[model samples]
Target: MTESDDIRSTLIDMLEELDDRLARITDDVKHTQEPLAKDSEEQAIPVENDEVLDYLGNSTRTETDQVNRAIAKLEQGHYENCEACGEHIAKERLEIVPFARLCVRCAEKSEE
Candidate 1:
């Protein structure tokens, strides 16, 4: 397979693994919530379970969406090209962040 195809496959695998891990974490957290609540007083700062769950859930959703979007971009003949300059993104960077939409130069300039 080509490099972009390889990257896409790896990212798909990573995202699926993340989804499984997040589901397990969510269930474990839910199971612990009741015991945690029973011991803590109401006035004791709320454990912020909702906030934590929301953050974790949103993160997983966003990551899944991003992975799908990246794959779509690949199919549409745009993979590895910087969105801003249309230059090929370095393979090293792509290896680090398979969903990257910008090359290092464009990304660096944007941070200014």
Candidate 2:
């Protein structure tokens, strides 16, 4: 299969995994609304639980957004190029992060 097809498949897999994780996070936070005695003991701080849930929610949103952007790039016919420098992103990097938007050099520069 072509590299585009492989990355497309990877993005699909990541999206599915994210969906499952978000669902589980939702379930975990929802059930804690009325914590049982054992659960209450296990979770000494309700605020901590809330914080964890919030963090997970934010992380899930970010990942979902990235995955969607990757899929859009794939559809737009430039999934292999860096959005910032118009250079081809390394295949190795794309294999690791299929939604990457910058080549290594540009990405490193942007970090500065």
Candidate 3:
């Protein structure tokens, strides 16, 4: 297959995986909070579990958003360019984070 076609397939697979993981996280959060789902207080939830679930939920949501943006960029033919500086994003960075929107230099500058 062509490179563009391959990349498109990769993006689709990534999106599907993200969606699956997010759904699992949502279900876990719901299951864990089931005891208090209606203010019954019939059962106590563990503090550590709550914290873990909260963190997972937030990270999953953020990752999902990032993947969506990446898909959009891929569709628009701008996935290789940094969002902030229009520079080409490094291949290494893209390999590590396929959803990255900024080049390493621009990302560092933005952090400051």
Candidate 4:
């Protein structure tokens, strides 16, 4: 398959994995699979766990959105162009981060 096709496939897979993780996190936070602890003291653990799970779910959702955007860019024939500078993003960078929207320089600047 072509490189863009490969990247698109990888992004789709990543999106699916993120979606599954978010679903599990949501279910865990809601106590869908297991009931809360009966003991008041024991309840603290699950509550703390739920907080962490919520954070993970949020991050996962963000990544899912990025992947979806990348897929859209690929469809539009603009996946290789950095959103910030309109420069071509490196092939190696794209291989490593299929959802990347910025090239290395722009990405570094944004982080600063």
Candidate 5:
């Protein structure tokens, strides 16, 4: 009903989607190095198994950390405020990046 609830619900939905995709990546990593029989086709995947595993692990960690930070911001009553300037974050920007920590102006300045 309220704007905060809407944002929270949206973020939860996004996090759930990320979790599902991360689970699939985990499965892929688990099966990437399946033992091949002597007669089985010796096919090398385009990416190295170790590299894929590392990449998947890092990606999952990053996503989880971002989700956690968003949840933390909500709990701390800072969800709609920019961390850098303490200004209210624009709804448009928040809709696009629910985990954003800065407003457009501050974000642009920081990038410079």
Candidate 6:
């Protein structure tokens, strides 16, 4: 298969995995499978776990959005260009992070 096709497949797989994780996190945070403990002390553990799950859910959702955007860019024939500086993104970086929108330098700067 062509490189873009391979990358598209990888990104789709990542998106599916992230979606599954987000669903599980949502279910856990909502206590849908089991009710919260009646004992206050026992309840604290699940509450703390829910906080972590919430954070993970948010992170997964963000990644899912990025993957979707990357897929769109790939289809538009603009996937390899950095969003910030319009430079060509390194193939190595793309291999590692197919959903990345910025080059290393621009990404570093954005973190500041």
- The candidate that wins on lDDT is 6
Clashes of 3: 0
TM-score of each: 0.75, 0.87, 0.79, 0.88, 0.79, 0.88
Cα deviation of 32 in candidate 4 (Å)? Answer: 7.5
lDDT of each: 0.80, 0.88, 0.82, 0.88, 0.81, 0.89
Writing each residue's lDDT as its tens digit, candidate 2 over 1-112 gives 9877877888999999999999999998888787568745666777788899989989998989999998998999988889987989998998888889899999999999
The lDDT, on a scale of 0 to 1, for candidate 2 is 0.88
> Candidate 1 at residue 68, lDDT?
80
Q: What lDDT does candidate 6 reach at residue 99?
A: 92
The best candidate by TM-score is 6
Candidate 3 residue pairs that clash: none
**Residue 49 CA displacement from its true place in model 3, Å:** 1.6
| Tens-digit lDDT string for candidate 3 (19-109) | 8887887788777765564565544555677788789878877887887888889889999999999999998898888889999999999
Off by over 4 Å in 5: 37-43, 46-50
Taking the tens digit of each residue's C-alpha lDDT, what string does model 4 give over 7-75? 888998998899889888888777733775676566667767877887898899899999999999999
- Give the alpha carbon lDDT tens digit for every residue of 45-65 in model 1: 435666777688888888888
Model 3 lDDT on a 0 to 1 scale = 0.82
Colliding residue pairs in candidate 1? none
Off by over 4 Å in 2: 35-44
In model 2, the number of clashes is 0
Ranking by lDDT: 6, 2, 4, 3, 5, 1
Off by over 4 Å in 3: 36-45
